[model samples]
Target: MFRALGAVLAAGLILAAAQVPATADTRAPARFSEFSVTPTSLDVDHPTATYTGRLVFTGADGTDQGVPGARVCLDKDGRCVATTETDADGRFSSPVTLSSTGAQPQLRDGEAEAFFNGDAERQSTFVGSGIALHVTQVQARITMGFDHTPSVVGDPVEVSGLLERQTPDGGWIGVVGQTVRVFVDGTRIAEGTTAADGTYRISTRVPVSDEGFWGVETPLPGRGYPYTVAFANTWQRAAHRTLVTGFNAAPEPVRKGAKLTATGRVMRVTADGSTEPATDYPVLQFSADGKKWTDLYEDHPNSQGYFSLSTPAERDGYWRVRTEDWPDLPSTSSVDYVDVGYRTAISGFNASPEPIAKGRRLTVAGTLKRDTTAWKAFSGQSVKIYFAAKGATSWTYEGTAKTSSTGHFSHTFTAAKDGTWRAIYAGSTTYVTVTGPGDYVDVR
Candidate 1:
């Protein structure tokens, strides 16, 4: 245990000891020794982004030793963000890497202090600023594109890129007449000097057998990044892959909830009008009016590059096969039209007691059935009756008939002049409308 003041009182101070210098004290005194940072500069952009410094104190014998444990902060304010302990060399290192992204390029100031293990009193050593650091957001970037991706490997491809600077107003301006290098697999293959508009075009060959990434890099000097990336190889332009998609579906006029078999074939286009089977494939996709395309099912293609998917004819829509784009292959799509139709049937339309006298009652009967599923009877449908004089271009509305439970409809008409009679139904969203040629009725 450290000697306490109790020991000083045990040996009572006498008037004779007062004759000694006023500064004389039995206990040792602690004072600031040394405080400094190495390198005197920091780069906030580096990954190892941290600063190191040390703090020490002088003993009563004038020998400097590193403080074992001390409180440290990054500002003049006495708040300790961290605590540091000294090593055998009396040196303490606290990392100063925690900085905000917006911190500007400026000197950082700090202070350090120590506390007695069991005492409230404290000693402080201030750290004046000397280190300079830069904190900023990188503003230079590049944009580039290819004329056609998935081209034949080992063949020539047109590659282009542009060097640009992000302005203060959030706009971009081209960095004109700059030397840019093109790299493939980290090897410099070609170089292009920027034009007046900061754009550069280079014709290069495929670097790899299957595929290889190509990028644009700039060698800007000084405070900025020494090797900065302007563009990354996103599209494999030197590709030698092609995907041919084709699709077909039946029955031509399928009904809702009916089994629909969609057929498709995937081929690799080696040349114009030439193709080979594509073994690696996925299922088909379908879409309806006002709806997005969705996968038909998780069905892979057969070894012959042929795929068939059976899905319920749920709605009116179109089906297509989608070929995904990958490392060396370009994508493609082929569509097949599908119409879900309603099988509507009109029957039993006849007038009883033909040749009836005018103003006499005549009964007309019929039935309206729609093939929802194998010709189900549609009941409660409103049917309009129309009549036209014999040899007339158009018919005139006569009356209305409401269908019964069996889809049977009947209307009693008082025979008027000679004319024709028929029933017409307006279509609904799911069913097709039905119209019929009138049953000729003669008036005596």
Candidate 2:
């Protein structure tokens, strides 16, 4: 009876053992043979980078073998940010885009890792012991230009430009609502905020500088981006400034062949808005049509910034003063228009028959001459005959006479009463009006 019972028990145990499933894995353990993240440094603009490595397992024969179709992942701060499956050769490549929140705290002080979760056939492991990465803020650049070239002193200068940040693909995008500052000769003068389009405009009256070096920049500090980098090649330029006032050309209706004087003040505007006499010279220029100009003369200003230039009047034109092109100062004054008329005279006047009967024919004659290099006959001119009663304040107009080729004019009129007779020549655009000497004519 005992032998029979043992046999049944052994059979039952064998049956139970056969029904139970196997729990042990027959595949080799898996691990990363090699793993690394390209371009250890990262930034907000270029937040994405690549991570590549190979997943391998120890083979049954004790040689490492490729673990094909295995999964691998990139871990950052204990979180899986990117994942990829190994190819036929156990190699895997995946892109990792860092989040702003993830990158902010790690700016200049963070690292990334590669991890793998164990599968049914392999044990879990990671290969990021020596691999390291860095997260950094994006690079910024400023491009700008002055609204007006060659700015004037004591006047506002407007500077405008776009602000941009570098991208991961080497492209650029505008940085909106950022503050930008302007500097003149290394001194901060103005600042403004960017618009939605990344454009900004700043206007300010910069102090005077001999070199006149101007530039713009964006400083990154205490603005939530401490690691942000600003390019050294910010927008820079060299410019000049000048101030000229109180310009005048005297003798508005200047007579031809007479001396005409031009006066003005040339000053330098200091940083404090004070004016002082500039040591530069002033050039006197004349323009016939106000479009083209000719340099007439130049002179230095006195201690009080006053200067005077004299020249002979020649024709109707415009005049202006231009500050000499000095390395430190340059400027131009407002234009002044001058009217110059030619000098004219009347000679050889005669009125015949003094103390005669009334209603007699009277003759008036005169020679009209224009003064140029020398006095010459003025032809094709009209002359009027005038008469004034004895001791009268004004003269009475009679008739007109045309001048001959020799500039001699004669007019005959019927006299009525005793009066003084004279010939007058009206002025033209190029000549001045003149009256001939009066001759007494009597009519009874």
Candidate 3:
């Protein structure tokens, strides 16, 4: 027994010496480095944003180094989720999905830790300073629309909307006492605060800008809330509305050959609540029907923002002024009107019996028309025939004829000598005057 005990003691000393090399080889310290967290601002209601981080090792020489195969863990409210190994650069990042398994379903502060297997000294025992990780709560909802569509430039356009929040019971309720801003063509034109029930309205006389789309924005304060520089988010990022109106050409029944003017104005609210001109020299337009507007090349606005374009009113049509569509503002059309009268056109005329003897009768005929029904015949129209001898410098009135229902007119006169004959239709208040080409009747 004594001999066996002496051999066992000698074997234990040899085994202890063999383990020394393995223990010292694992002495590298696991330390956290520059760990960071994002989503400094997250909505309490949605809370869908992820939290991500990094880690490095502390060498024996007290220097930062990336340690591979070391475990790192994330903690929220003191309980922890398991860590993954430090990667190529000693960096590890993952989202903090929840507080912890079996913990409360609530917002909580979070931290990070690094651990080395089989070493208690290198594992994290307390939260470190200068590290950020959190779950935040700040939420909002917004809705907007225009009260009056197709409004005039000087008319009050009412922009209204609601600011709401979700209740614990999953129902949405209004947010009261919050300020909301309204814009036209990217310019702030009005503002209002939410009422007790969460509704907001602003009836401001705005200038005509672009065609129609307006903007509405509302920012919520993060004080005493979850959002800071990191949690910077809001519901106003998507508020866009529209202000609509129509264009017109005033005063119908514009007589033929008279000048008709085109006109419109745009009024905009300044930042200080004063009104000013919204657009310059909007394009003048005309259309036979109200549906399609054509650009009128002749007229534009004067220096004082007054628009007038004189165009011959020869055909019946509609007229108005319009602006181009912009990203922030809707294209606009002003209310105006145009009713053109007729333009007279002599279709044709001729003298029959090209060669006639003296004392023989000659016949002259012609047709008259207006543009109302596109070259429709003009009945009961008076057509005057004129005669001019071969050497006569001016024509003399010969005879008159009334047009039939088909726009035909005729007259017979004695052919006393070689002469040229012509037909003319004196225009009325609605139709323009016209004359047909002369026809020669040679009398021998």
Candidate 4:
């Protein structure tokens, strides 16, 4: 019996030693070297933009670690900007400012990388892997037409709109109590705050300009509230409570072969004797037949909001002139068409270098093929050129010249600088239509 008991004890001791808790050799310290952010791209169209709401970092072993920091720096083209960091729960938050000119505030194309000293005891850098953010600023619409040319300066001009806010659903959330800042030629002029109804009223002195219209910028403060920039002149009036307005300022008609240049001032008529210039608006020139037209000039509104555009030679037919409203003024025409002449079909012709490079001589040259070869020449057809730029949607006339007796027409357009450009040719009484969307070219 004693020998059997001793054998059982020896077997139990051997089993216990085999199980020995797998030994200290099986345990090791963790090491990592890689990190990333989520979503991969940041879009800046809304003032209140957010990432997937998190920063995700990765390690050399493909393991994830949360980044901890209240602030992160991002550089664009050379300008560096900072964003706030996450909270203790591994979340960071920050307000994005969209009004910095040096930073390329339009968030659509801006980007940055996030980094932090994470787990200092391990000497590891917590960096997010492959994260993207889409951010944007809220847009503001100013009341009145493109050119405000009010007949008087210092009169109370009512400006109203919703302070747009952005929501997490990648959409806009309209809010009230936003501040509207007024600026003229890059200078602050006045400010007003929006009410609960998302509207603002401001009384300000008009900036000095040859034309009454002034460049106006309204910046709303908050996360993702984009700065709004616009122009207003005194020549046109708001038709009703809605933002729509009509250009009451008419062009002084000119006749063909006449030496008289079309010259005039644009003003907005008000109940009071006050007047504002239409400089912020562009001056348009229409052909006598009213079918073909050209833009002549864009002038800055004078302190009194006044502007004038002159044609060097006498105009041949009926011409109309006006500024373009934001959101585009309702026009009877579709697809930006113009009639050139009789018996020739010139369709799908696109123009290039909109606003026709300023000071640089531009050749308004494009392929001109008539459906019917029987129509040999587009002779003496009046080819008119129009110009505009980023700030100016309204077209201005650079110059107009007639085509030679041959079927081909070319005009030397000399502008003061580079801008968007388009051209139209008036052939006989019929207008020629361009074939496709106008082309854009950079001369500089």
- Best-fitting candidate, scored by lDDT: 2
Candidate 3 lDDT over residue span 1-444, tens digit each: 999999999999999998786535444445565555555433444443333444555766877877655566655445555556667776766665442111133243444333334244454422265344454544557787767662444556677887776665778777666667776666777778778888888777655555445667664334433322111111221111222233345445555666776555544344344554444446666777779877865343455445555666656776656554332234455545555567666766888888988988888988887776577899998999899999999999987899999999999988898989999887765776677888988898
Residue 256, model 4: lDDT of 26
lDDT of 2 by residue, 1-444 (tens): 999999999999999999999897665577888888777776665667688888888776988788888878787656677788989988988887765431123323355677778787778788748456665667678787777763455566688888887777888878776777777777778888778777889887755656667777775542335236342223333323556788889887677878889998887766557777776788889999999999988987888878999988888899998886554367889999988887778899888766667777777888888887788898898999899987789988998988888989898878788889888877877776777888887677
Instruction: Kindly report which residue stretches of model 3 are placed more than 4 angstroms away from their true locations once superposed.
Output: 1-340
Model 2 residue pairs with clashes:
357-444, 358-443, 358-444
Off by over 4 Å in 2: 1-179, 193-208, 216-225, 228-258, 263-282, 285-294, 301-307, 313-324, 327-396, 399-423, 427-432, 435-444
Task: Report lDDT (CA) for all predictions.
Answer: 0.62, 0.76, 0.61, 0.44
lDDT string, candidate 4, 1-444, tens digits: 999999999999999998887644322222223323343333333333333234445556876555544344433323444555555534655444433221124443344444443343233232334234444444445442222433333344544345444455656544454556655545666777656654556666444434333444345333432334433423322221111123222222212222333334444433244443433354545565666666655555465544444453333344445555432232221111122232343333444445444466666654343333354555655556667764576877777656566645556655455556566654343333432234454545
Per-residue lDDT value at 431 in model 1 = 70
TM-scores, all candidates, are: 0.35, 0.39, 0.28, 0.27
Worst 10 residues of 2 by lDDT: 100-109
Q: How well does candidate 4 score on lDDT at residue 247?
A: 29
Candidate 2, lDDT over the whole model: 0.76
Per-residue lDDT of candidate 1, residues 1-444 (tens digit): 336676666555654477576763433333434454443343324312233455555656876665555444443124443455556554555554433111111222323233222112334545544333332334668877776663565556677878776655778777665667777767777777777777889777656533356677665532423223356566454443556455677875676788888777666644333566766455567888525888767466787778887888877788766666453364545667776767566788877669889999998889988886477667998999988887789989988898898989989989987878888887566776678656888998
Q: Sort the predicted structures by TM-score, highest score first.
A: 2, 1, 3, 4
Q: What does the lDDT read for residue 145 in candidate 1?
A: 76
Against the hidden true structure, what lDDT does model 1 obtain?
Answer: 0.62
Candidate number that wins on lDDT, 3 or 4: 3
What TM-score would candidate 1 get against the native?
0.35
